[model samples]
Target: MATHSSEINGPDVNDPAINGPAINGPAIEVDRLTVRRGGRTVLDGIGFSCPPGSITGLLGPSGSGKTTLIRALVGVQIITDGTVTMLGMPAGSAALRSRVGYVTQSPSVYSDLSVAENVRYFAAVFGLGTAEADRAIDDVGLSTAARQVTGSLSGGQRSRVSLACALVARPEVLILDEPTVGQDPLLREDLWDRFHTEAAGGTTVIVSSHVMDEANRCDRLLLLREGTIIADGTPADILSRAGTDSMDEAFLSLIRHSMAGGRSTDEVTS
Candidate 1:
C-alpha cells in the first residue's frame, strides 16, 4: 500500500525497476510438509505453492493447524518431514531475512514505545528510514496515532501497529496470521484492501482466517481441517467442486468427504 519505488520491490520479470528479472516460479512452495508436537500429529503431509501477486487464504476452524501451518511457512515451526521454500530459498533461511514479512496473531511491537517509534524500529531493520515508517503507518490509517504510546492504544490499534511494522519492510512475501481478529469490520476491509494492493504489486500474501467470508477475498484458498488440508482452489472452485454456494457448506462437505476416507478429486492436494 505504501509504494516506495526502491524499497517496495517485487519479483516480477516485467518490472522495469529491478536490474534482473526474478526467477519465474511460485513465491512459496511446500512438499509433503508434516509436523508433530508432543508426539501428536499437528500437521499432516501437505503440499502447495503460492504464486506471486496472489492472496492465499488459510481457512479452518480452531485447532485446524492453520496457525501451525503458518508458523512453518514463516520458518518458526519445526517440521517432522518435508520441505518449505520461500522466494526460491528454504524457509527461515538467513538469505530471506528482509524478503519475508510476518505478523503473528499476537502483536509483536514494543508496548513501551510510541506507535511511530515501534514502526521506525522495524523499518530500521530493513535499512529503511522515517519516511518509510510514516508511510506504513498511514497505509494502515494509524498516522493519527503515530505519536501515541503503543501501550495506550486499544487492542485493534495495537494490531494495526504490528501490521504497520510488517508493511514497513515491503517484503516480497507477507504472511499475516489472523490479522483482523481485534479489528472492526471497517478496519478489516481497509486491511484487506491493503493486502490486495500488496498482492497486486507481486508480493505473495498468505492470510490466515477462521472466518469463511474472508475466503472470497483471496485468489486461492487452502481449507485445513484437523491437521490436514481439505480444500485448495479459488473461492468459486471450492464452492463449485463442493456443489454448494455457501463456503460453510462447502467446508462441511469436504470435511465429510475426508472423513469418509476418500481424497477430494479436486479438493485437497498433497
Candidate 2:
C-alpha cells in the first residue's frame, strides 16, 4: 500500500465529523508523558501527535522505550508526569478504551477454543452481538478456519484471530504493538496490505514495529530511543535528513547523531 506524504504530516488525522474540542484534536496527543519503572526512567518527557485516519508507525530498537510509550497511550502503565489523549479523551478512560482496540505482541488467544469460538468469546467480552462478531471474523479473513481449534492453528492464523478480536468492536483507533512479530515476510506483507485497507476506510492505526522494511508502508514514522522521539516524519523525510537511502541506515545514522550530542531522540532531555 502506498501513502502520500501529506497524510504523514499533521493535518487530516482525526475525523472532523466527530469533532469535539478533544476527540477531534488529534488521533493521539502526548505531552510530557513520563513513565518510570523501579526508579529508572523508562520514558521521559515523550510527546507527539498522530492525526486521525493515519497509519503511524512507532519505530525504534528494542529497549528504546517503544513498549513504554505504547503502554502510556493505552493508559496501561502509570504516567509519572504529563498527559496522553486518544481521540481527544484522556488515555485509559472508559470512553477512550471503548473506542480503541489494542493488540499486543504476545498471542492473547484462547488456545483451547476453536477459531470461531475464540472470536465469539472476545466479541461477547466486548459486548458485540452475533452478527457483529461474525462480520469481524470475516473481515480478518478468518472465515475459512473459523471452526479450526485455535491451539491447532499456525502462528500466523493465531495472529489473525487476535486481530479479528481487536477489530470486533469497531473502535475508532487500533493500537498494535509489534503486530507482525514471528511471521514470515510474505505474511507480514499480507498483514500490511490488510492494515492499509482498513486505514483507508477510516480507522486510525498506531502500530509499533521494529521491522524497518515495513516502515515505508506507514503514513508517518515515529523514531524513538530510550523513551524519547529521535525523529518524526515520513520515511522519505527521515532518509532525506539523514542523507541515507534506506530506513535501516537512516535509523542507525540518526541514532549515532543523536547520541553524539548526548540526546536520546526528538524526545531526548538535556
Candidate 3:
C-alpha cells in the first residue's frame, strides 16, 4: 500500500497549539493485559509497546482477539487483569478521551443522519467546529457523499463516515478495528496512505486487520493467534528471521516454532 504525506486541512499536527509538546515515551504500553468474556479468557497476557509516531499493525485471523485488544487500548473493553497505559496515563482516563480516537469494526454513525450531519455531530461532541468536520469528511474521501443519508450509503461509505468521526478529533492515538474490511483495493490503499500521513505527523496508529498482505504497510507488526502474541517485529525482520519471503509463510513458520516450544524469532533478535 502507498503511504501518503500530503497535508490534510485539519489540526496542524506540527502546530504547538494543537499537539502541545513533543510527547516522550511510547504512545501505548501494555503489560500482562488480559480479558475474559463468557468465562473464557479472550486476551491472555498480551504485552507490547507502540512507539510514538509509528504505525503498528495487529494481524490475526478472526476470533484471534484483535478487536478485544483494541477495545482495551481505547478503554472500552473490560479487562480481567493487567494494565494498558496510553500516552503515559492509564487507559480510559477521562483526560485521554479526546486524545484517543477509535473506529470499531461496525459503523457507529447515526443511520438517520446525513454523512455531513454525523460528522458535525461528532465534531461538536469533540468540542470542535464545522471546519474540523469538513476536513475529516474530506480526509476520508467522503466529500461527494457528505449530503447523503448515512443509511443510504454503501457499507464502505458508512465505514468512512465512522472513520471521519474519529479523525475529526485529531487524536494523538488512533485505534481502528478492521477499517478496510469491505473496502475496494483503491480505497484501501488510500486509507493506508491517510494512516501513514497521521503517523508522520506524530500520531500513534494501531490498526487491526486479518489480512496478512496488509501487514507489509505497517512500521511494526504484532501477530496474534488465539489471544496470544506469536510474533512482534518489523515485516522485513520477521521475514528474514522466519526464513520466508511472504508474511503468510512467515506467520506459519513462527506458529510452528512457537507450538514446538522454541522462542519466537522476534525474541532472539530483540
* Candidate models: Cα lDDT each: 0.88, 0.81, 0.89
The best candidate by lDDT is: 3
Candidate 2: 10-residue stretch with minimal lDDT = 10-19
For model 3, state the Cα shift of residue 108 in Å.
1.0
Q: Per-prediction TM-score, please?
A: 0.90, 0.88, 0.90
| Clash statistics: count for each candidate | 0, 9, 0
Colliding residue pairs in candidate 1: none
Question: In candidate 2, how many Å is residue 143 off?
Answer: 1.8
Q: What tens digits encode model 2's per-residue C-alpha lDDT throughout 101-185?
A: 8887777899899988888888888887778878987877778888889999888778878988888888778989898987888
Candidates, ranked, TM-score: 3, 1, 2
RMSD of each: 5.1, 4.4, 4.4
TM-score of 1: 0.90
- Summarize candidate 1's per-residue lDDT along 14-86 as a digit string, tens digits: 3535423555788899999999999999998989998776899998889989999999998999899999999
User: What global local distance difference test value does model 2 have?
Assistant: 0.81
lDDT of 3: 0.89
